[model samples]
Target: MAFRKFSFLSLVAGGVAQTGLAPKKFNSLPLGAIRPAGWLSDQLNVQMNGLAGHQHEIHLDVSQVNNTDWTGGSGYYSNLEEAGSYWFNAAVPAGILSNNAVFNNLTLNFLNYVIDHQDSTGWLGPEVGTTKPRYLWGRYPFFFGAIQLVEHDPTLADRVVPALHKFVQVANTMLHNNGEGVDDWAATRWEDFVMALQWLYDFHPNGNEALLIDTMKMLKATGDPWEQVFATANFPTKAVDNTPNPFPVLTWHGVNMAEGLKALPSTFRFTHNQSDLARASEGWDNLFKFHGRPSGIFAADEYLAGLEAHRGTELCLVVETMFSGSFLYQVAGDPKYADRVRSFSSVAHSQPLTPRHMWTRQYLQQQNQIAAKNMTPNPFPNDGPYSNVFGLEPNYRWPKFITNSFVVTPDNKSLVQVYLGPFSTSTTLAGNNAVTVTVDTQYPFSDTVKTTVKAAQAFTYLVRIPSWVVGGTIAVNGAKATAVAPSNGLHAVNIAAGTTSLVLNLPAPITTESRPHGAIAIHRGPLNYAFDIPRTQKILARNAAEPRAVDLEFDSSGTWQFAIDPSTLKFVPRTVSALPSPVFDQAKPPFSMTVTACPISWSVAGDTFAAVPPTSPRCTGANTTLTLWPYGATKLRISEFPVMHA
Candidate 1:
């Protein structure tokens, strides 16, 4: 199939004039429109069973905080404040509006508290320092949640719009004076403010809302200069040691990079400057090239730690990268941007091995393989029972919530699949109210997807063909579609009103890639397969303030040092009669696979699996059978291993 380049405006109304390529304009469905179906739905339901999703408990705590004087008051810093931020902005509102009954009323008390208590001037958040308005950073999440609330219930728009205008006026004044320190967190995280303000600018009922966003962008730029930072694109060198900084560099901090990655992309949405787009794309390339792991993210055990197989990525950084990619894909309208989202999504949802308690800790205290500048020395430094304590919420279970599964085409008439999984959705097309779509498949585990569309009238359907899928085929109404071809990572098909079944078969070949230090990473489909090492967990208090806060230490009983026989890298797939409940449970993965391997002489480094396995070491043991599990499903695992040479 031939490809064509088109402008973003073609997708403005969710309608498109196709000239042989997938349309560029695509927007997300309403927060709750397309929901998780099949095993994906089960995973979300399981998450709600824990603190992460216990809507009432989480929101109740949030309401109590909201009712207090901490938000834009004297006692603001008394609590983390973000504990409430995640509940309103992330957890409850999205879940509730998504039609999940579990979140019912969970969003109510919190919304009511904000409505009743928000100062007449539109100030929200704790009032700290002499400045009348506090930090710009804290208010962003509040508005993020408010936007979600307004979408779920439009009546709140009456209150939300005016309140935001007032807040914008106050923020504009602060930036004009350049006197108050309102730029504290906002200086470092100016991109997030851009994200929230842009949403307000796009969706606000008042057409003049763009002015508010203009003021915000102008003011925020003067403070942090993230736009300049991105345009110059200088800071993060290939390795931390290579940078000019003589001390620990806060500039390349993982969370900051994740949040800042979207700076240029978001700015391009307003400026339409081609330079911003180029810099945005260049930023992503540099990040992945120097620091990216097989999981499609760079090593930032809090900061840029260079590319080492075993260096752990902070869960927050992982989540933030996913968020940034979500924005970049829509802004750039490039399938490769969407492809990056899929890569981060798969690793985050399927192989997130980091325990929940350590998520909030700034530094990942894991076994380091390569030693570099500002990194903790290897072989276990003992300093009176060391715990790099950062008293923050662990939020381990929240990664499952870090996804926006579908995007409504810019015309609002069609839909595009972004995060691949079993899902169902309906959009108004040809003036029909009930055009239903049900997508059934165990994606990643199984590449075959069967989408059944039932429409009262005809509508166009666009399904994203991931970059990894080659020689993919589509069968419509049980017949192979010989005439249609998908080249730009998408396939467009027209569906007539009556029941139409589309079966898509994506090639899931067993593949391997060579890694640093003679290591190799294995994959089948979207999942990265790993050796599920047998181990026991030793629990330790995460800190003194919150003794209940704990971290896990694993002691493995099984040997982890092994080399796969590349010629013998066979995959035996199993189809289960039913998916296991609590599917993410480490020992109870929904699917299973077995492979053959040979044990090699391996050594440990930094009291954990060595960074690099011995390259082509002498075979210390006969060929043996080893079971490989999904990387996300294992608590203790070695996903990359040495390729042995006998």
Candidate 2:
């Protein structure tokens, strides 16, 4: 397995040693509870499967020169190798340990490579003598892997611990060897080693805690710049050399390293310092304030879209954000993290590499609906099928990071996360050792959900019934069961079904919300809406507001009425078509909108004006009852309907 190029199958053809180590207990914030365990598992499986053949296989390139030559120190091939190993350690022994064979096979091969190569210093990873560079290298994989495998197999632990010792030696030597203090980006940094060592202390030979703290303190003294974000902005950087446009990118490495910083203390039992916490806070605040999209994802469009329309983001940033979101949720315990995770899962993670799982695009997404940076521009581009650099590039399966791991609350309770089709999750009944219950549901597209419970002993099961669940009746066997929506959001139920069945009514459907210009929009859940304007017609987008000037209003008659503020709406005369026999013509550059919906409404809520979307719209442009629905649905009709207030 070459370090720079990522491939699915393990590069190591041989096998690894067998070892059993103590498992590190997982303590993710309630972030992932918002998703069905099944859905999350399925996605993780896809990633793992892509990475299955690659345990012994590794991508160890390290020369950071990304120009046409691909030369020089080539950054660090070892960094990627460490990352691959980390993935195996953290992900393999997780909820879906069924996939252990994938990494087991890889570990078997890895042990073959590192076992005999250790010197007295005990370092097994790459370095030039005692002099090591100061940058992030993902070395914790070995320690984590050893810890996870220790209890189950001791032979593996014996073989791996020596390698960890060598790592500690080299790391200790690197900070002091150059005789200069913790200052700049060498091959590795104090924070980088701290993360790995922290994990090693928890899982490996119970590493040197005092030394680990000293190593970490180096980063504090070194100082931090723009502490609010993890990635350094290489705006207008050339995309991995293959793509045409030089994309603006916020590399995932920086934030990921900080995340690594976040990961370390838990294992070390070090109370997080206020400065590091401040750095993380300001970093995220700035990141979201600048690059955050409405979808809760930060921009990584490669060229860092400047005034010119030609920058791009990376596939890496998407996966990295998932990790960040997981951490933030742990700190804040807010539902927004779940919302962000759900949004990413529903949008960014769902798209396949080659429309199938067979291939993948190196840079996974684009901010502009029609990625125009590397355009074949004889014809203009708009909202059509977006594209990425799709092929069998390194990772088609268990990605090194991002979109790969599963989340769970510290205590096992199903958060009524995603309403999906036919899903099931099992956990021990609350406070009972012998009882286990698995709830299954077929939801969203359908109304009725069936849940079944099984246990050897009697216990209570608390299932969250979503607020969206309306007029629901619970039943056991064939009789009615009691259910309650305690507080505003959660639904509580007590069940002692050793092996029982449950049926619930999920009568949730789309709800309505009003938008700008007295226009009404339909909403199903958290999604906003846009009219599925047909390609044959042209419409405008208006975005402006006048202080104290109420120009649009909604009436009890179900129509949004507005007075024209010539400044608010303008038009860009371009026509587009919807689905075509051959193909859908891409959406055109948006037009300038002409009307504003900033008036008052006379709904039961009284005289205040709400920014509602018009539910009806068409060519007569001047006075139309523009119809609107939530952004999630739109097979037809106008979304931004206009109205006239007499």
Candidate 3:
């Protein structure tokens, strides 16, 4: 009952039909279609110095002859393929957009590696061994990476499309030979490969895509049915000891759950099954009900850790969830899913990005020292696909964060703005006329957004009014227009033939939200406010044998045991002439808020401060005027706090 398998065809024939679904529906924009402007552009440029840009530097080191994870090593496996997969998909594309020559060269080198090395038997990745079976996990990223590569350079399509054909044939054979038991990593994650297949089938329908899609689905259908996993809520919601052995199964793992959120929905895209949509929504509800945090992420150190504020979420899961949410929104075309993107972008993913950047600088210096020592297997866990790789890959969760979220309407007539970051989109209208729209604002810090649209002709622009903004208003060319209502999240305004300004005002007010155990978190719109506790860092060696292998630990500098006086919360904005070096930098935050708070007694278990704040902490210290920073700004913060006596 736990490991039953169901075919994609069986699901469709068993009631779900392909009728009424469009023969061709493109839900996502190309890799570089939407360009970043203002601070968002600056953030992309800053990433090159870290892991995102320098993958070529560590690629050879991590996959060389002596490394245990790659060819010629004792294991004779391709552990680095997953990391290489992301490098080509994200790091390379970002480098090309930023015009970083070194990164572009690195990316080309990786693409050339695949193009130059297709074996006579049509095998692509690292050399497969006789005794050990090749893992189907890394192939998913490589397939998607190839698709993106061709989008950037069509000449590569000649190489990429054939390579995928070879991979599909070989992998399909392996699936049948194995008699149904799927690899643990590959079982829950095959939806990503199915999605890639759908993308390929959309582009090259005449090619082997039709057969390839069915073959891949046949491969996945033999694995775990994710639809049932979520529909029945089969896994444990609490943190448990599965260490000495990996979680006997995969369903309960937080990262997999977060990444798999779009699985059933994506399947629904092809099957057009309404039940898949209902199940996807129910899965999300279950996650939040059991382990959701105010940080806009479900707690998972490595697994679902329940709704304890101090219980941390992985940086990887945060990024994956954002990607999943964005994909789900695009496929479902629902604004509610888009709102989930706003929360994670403004709070969860944004916070980890800055700290990952700081850690990356230290990581690069250590990598150089480690290389000089000639260590095997790189000993550095935070490289490539691992979130801790302390590189730009982890720092900037999605290179297409804004582009993927803001997609063209199905009719190719209008643009839908799902995210708040500053970006510009240029598209061809109905009559082959080109249109470009530029959005300018310091959103999450300020509620006002000004959009300048220059078009060949007049068209309807649909701007999404975020759910948090209740009393929103829209003005055309600086004049207040009552046509745009605040109640509906979607606001459509028509622009003249030439240049026109569409001003949107979403005033955010201070609000408090209750936590699990009598604690509360403050919010102004999408941004969550936290008590900025002063703290110092200590660098510790992750592995004693390798001095260069390190991670940072934070200790309370002054005192973090304080509760907010909910009545004295005052908001203040600091005028910044330019954006910070890294947009989420704590040292130079864009805004500040003053609050009156008193110290209380709180205990710390290992590294994290207590999740549940003291139920009735005595106000022993003086009521001092303390400064609270945005959730994304501070590293050591007490965002959920107990209420103090006036």
**Per-residue lDDT of 1-646 in model 2, one digit per residue for the tens?**
0111212121111222212221222333111122233333444554444422332233233112112232222223244344544444544343224345645544444444444545565555444243664333445455544544553456766666666766666656654444233333322223444445555564554546656544444332332322322333422222222334221122233334324334322212333333434445444545554444433354443322211112233445555456555545444333344345434432334223221232233343332222211223211122121224332224422221221122233454332222223344433423553433344532332345576666655544444344444565667666865554533233444555457676766454444333334544333333333333332211111112212111111112233333222223323222333211111112211221223443432221113222333333322344332233222222122333333343
Mark the 10 consecutive residues where model 1 has the least summed lDDT. Answer: 366-375
Q: After superposition, how far is residue 391 of candidate 1 from its true place, in Å?
A: 12
lDDT of 2: 0.37
Candidate with maximal lDDT: 3
TM-score per model over all chains: 0.83, 0.55, 0.86
Model 2 off-target regions past 4 Å? 1-104, 128-136, 140-155, 176-207, 212-269, 272-290, 302-313, 362-364, 371-373, 376-387, 396-439, 442-497, 500-646
Query: In candidate 1, what are the lDDT values of residues 339-375, reduced to their tens digit?
Result: 7766655455433233432222323322222111122
Top candidate on TM-score is 3
List the candidate 1 regions with Cα displacement exceeding 4 Å: 1-24, 54-81, 97-104, 128-133, 179-184, 205-207, 223-237, 245-250, 349-392, 396-403, 429-434, 481-484, 541-551, 590-595
For model 1, state the Cα shift of residue 280 in Å: 1.3
Higher-ranked by TM-score: 1 or 2:
1
List where candidate 3 sits over 4 angstroms from the true fold.
1-4, 7-10, 13-26, 58-80, 128-132, 178-181, 232-237, 240-248, 346-396, 481-483, 486-488, 541-550, 606-608
Candidate models: Cα lDDT each: 0.59, 0.37, 0.63
lDDT of 3 by residue, 1-646 (tens): 1343464555563565564233322266676667887877777765665544543434343323223223342211244346656555666568756867766665566666665666665666665433455677676776776787677677787777777777677767766665332578777777887778777676754467557656655655756566776764464555533433223356666678887897887677566667777788878777876777665667765667666664446666776788887887777666677776677664543433435353242111110010111123332222322222222223445575766746767777776677876888887766775788888987765677888999888877777777777677788897865545632466777777889888887877788878766888787777777765576666543434333324554445777778778899998887776667676767556777788888887765433335357776789888888887777666557778888844
Best-first order by TM-score: 3, 1, 2
Separate clash counts for every candidate? 15, 116, 5
